[model samples]
Target: MNIRLRSAVAGDYDAVNAIIREGQDEHAEALPDRFARLDQVVAMGWYRSFSKQPNKEIIVAECGDKLVGVAMLEMKQSPSFEALVPRTYAYLNELAVASTHQRQGIGKKLYTASLAWARERGASSLELNVWEFNERAQQFYASVGMRTLHRMLFTDLT
Candidate 1:
């Protein structure tokens, strides 16, 4: 199957939302307290707002006439502070491939496009956050040459 990667347009709202909702549903099921499944209206609205950010982009993977995957990216800079190094980077806010279309290299295409987009815009690095419960996602990311940067820990104070 041929997969085409391109910048998303306003007309892609529904398809993109559907793909995102799949991932959201999984997250919600795995961690009810941390993830909430969004309704279509709310998801679409949030996508609209997020896509409009000046330093953000939404990349979609299309198979023939269907949108099967999406990657949301954001350009960010490390804050100038005494304890931090200054640099610009690209953040992979979200990446989701439709349940029916996984393992066909669509995710890799989206990721390649995202990296190129960041490189073209002078970003020095690419980063993303994956929840521990999503082992599949972690494995996919690792297969693409990403490694653990840091771990976020939390305590239940109850």
Candidate 2:
């Protein structure tokens, strides 16, 4: 696929939100109720503020006039750690490739673009989160050189 990657604009919000929902559905296995309660619009409304924030961008992948993927990136310093100094890094808050467009390298293209942007902006590292239930996503990230920094575990008490 001939993919064009660029920063998102307000006009791309609905398409971008749909792409995000694709990811949410994939992870719904881990938190079905939580995902169910997310009024899609409210969950995606953060874009209004993210669009205004400095050092933040939402990238959209276009394939012949259609957006097939979207990724959100934020550059910020690591939260203060009493024993260590904070370092700036890029956080990949979200990355979603449309279900029909998977395996065509759209995700990788979006990721590479985000990485280059981070590097150009002086971020020391790039980080992201993947739910344990989404093993495919974890493996994909690993294939792109991302490793397990830590695991977040949980159990149902209900």
Residue-wise C-alpha lDDT for candidate 2, range 78-120, written one tens digit per residue? 7798986889999999989999899899999999999998998
Lowest lDDT sum, 10 consecutive residues, model 1, at 41-50
Question: Taking the tens digit of each residue's C-alpha lDDT, what string does model 1 give over 1-158?
Answer: 99988888889998988998899899999999988878672366667766788688999999999999999998999999989989999999889999999999999999999999899989999999999999999999999999999999999886
TM-score of 2: 0.91
Residue pairs whose backbone atoms clash in candidate 2: none
User: TM-scores across all candidates?
Assistant: 0.93, 0.91
Clashes of 1: 0
Going through the candidates in the order shown, the clash numbers are 0, 0
